[model samples]
Target: MSKVVFITGASSGIGKSIGLYLHGKNYKVYGTSRNPSKVNVPFSMVALDVTQKESIKRAIGEVIGIEGKIDVLINNAGKGITGPIEDTPTEEMKFNFDTNFFGVIDVIKEVLPSMRLEKSGLIINTTSIAGYMGLPFRGVYSASKGALELVTEALSMEVKSFGVRVVNVAPGDFATNIAAGRYHTPVFENSAYKEKYAENLALMDSHVSSGEDPMMMAKAIYEIIKSKSPKIHYKVGGFMEKFSIILKRVLPDKIYEKLLMNHYKL
Candidate 1:
């Protein structure tokens, strides 16, 4: 039987790339979007809002009703935020977690029973390289993805006996519309972080604009799906981007902080 794959946030960007690529490979692919009718794609795009629990339930139920089981679940639906921790609204960070962290968990919970029943499943979480460190002006975004990474670790072991595998795929940066959709706290003229926040905001967007192709991530996902024993974490990105994770492990804490500060020109 062709494997059934369900992905969230498939309306655009990396999620869309994964869906289309998997569809071309003859896998049964179903993706999610808040407004399915707004976009057109070769694979199925169901109505889903990660922030809403009922929506997640309904979407997964729809897929399972037809396919009877999901072989792979890609948690790709997420939002981004950029600003100084102090300057950014607290509510904004909470909302970001609602989508990026909590929403992913809820979706996994909904799919786990079916996966466990079938005695096999793969869960690929879309995390970020930023999650490995607290970057300047992107602290909130970093925290959310970091939390998801930790949960993936915990869940992977917890579900091992059930034959359900959970892993994180952290991408450094990829050219996408995430920049335009990100919640950017304004650089208030009187705020202490005004100048630095504005400058870093632009830097964040530029990285996305010049980042690697989304198909790279899509290809990585496909490989993971086919693996017999996939690793706990898989990172996809440029040389420096993936190397940064290694540097974090070997470098002194203070030196690593300095390197990031210099890179961001802080």
Candidate 2:
């Protein structure tokens, strides 16, 4: 039997591309959205709001009923929040964490039992390069992804003995419909960072709009899935973005900060 793959946030963007690509590769792919009815993809669709525990359980149950076991689980559901950290409201930050961090945890908890029983599974998380370096106006979004990356790292060790592998795929800018889902925190008229926030937000959006094709990410994901033993982290994107990860690790603290400030024109 072919491997069964379940992916979240598949109504559009990178998740949708991954689903379609995997389907073409003969995997029995199951994709999820909060509202599956609106998803017109060729693979199976499940209604899953990753932030809701009941929704996660129901969706996983439906898949298990048909496939009996989930060979791969891709936690791709996430949202973006942009604003100066001080200006970002508490509720907005919570919402970002809800979707990007807690949501991933919810689905992983639901699917782990079956994976543990089988003594084998692959859990791939879609993190971001922004997670490594806190971008100027996207602090919360970066925090969310960074937290997920840490969780993925720790999970790899915790589940290793159970025969489950966890990996984080951190992508730089990618062309997707994420702009629509991104929430811009309200900037008060008297805020100190208002003007700089606006300029930085615009620059970030432009980078996303002109990002590399989503297919590159989808292809990278496929290779990881097909590997006999995949690494714990995979970085995918343009040269500078990929190199930034290495630079951040090796560069002096003040020098790296200067490079980041210069890149964002801060």
TM-score of 2: 0.98
Error of 1 at 116 (Å): 1.0
Q: 73-137, model 2: which lDDT tens digit per residue?
A: 99999999999888888998998999999999989999999999999999999999989987788
> How much does each candidate deviate from the true structure in C-alpha RMSD?
0.6, 0.9
lDDT of 2 at 103: 93
Per residue, candidate 1 scores C-alpha lDDT tens digits across 198-218 of 888888999999999999999
Model 1 lDDT-worst window of ten: 193-202
lDDT for 242 (candidate 1): 88
For candidate 1, give the lDDT: 0.95
User: What are the TM-scores, per candidate, against the unseen true structure?
Assistant: 0.99, 0.98
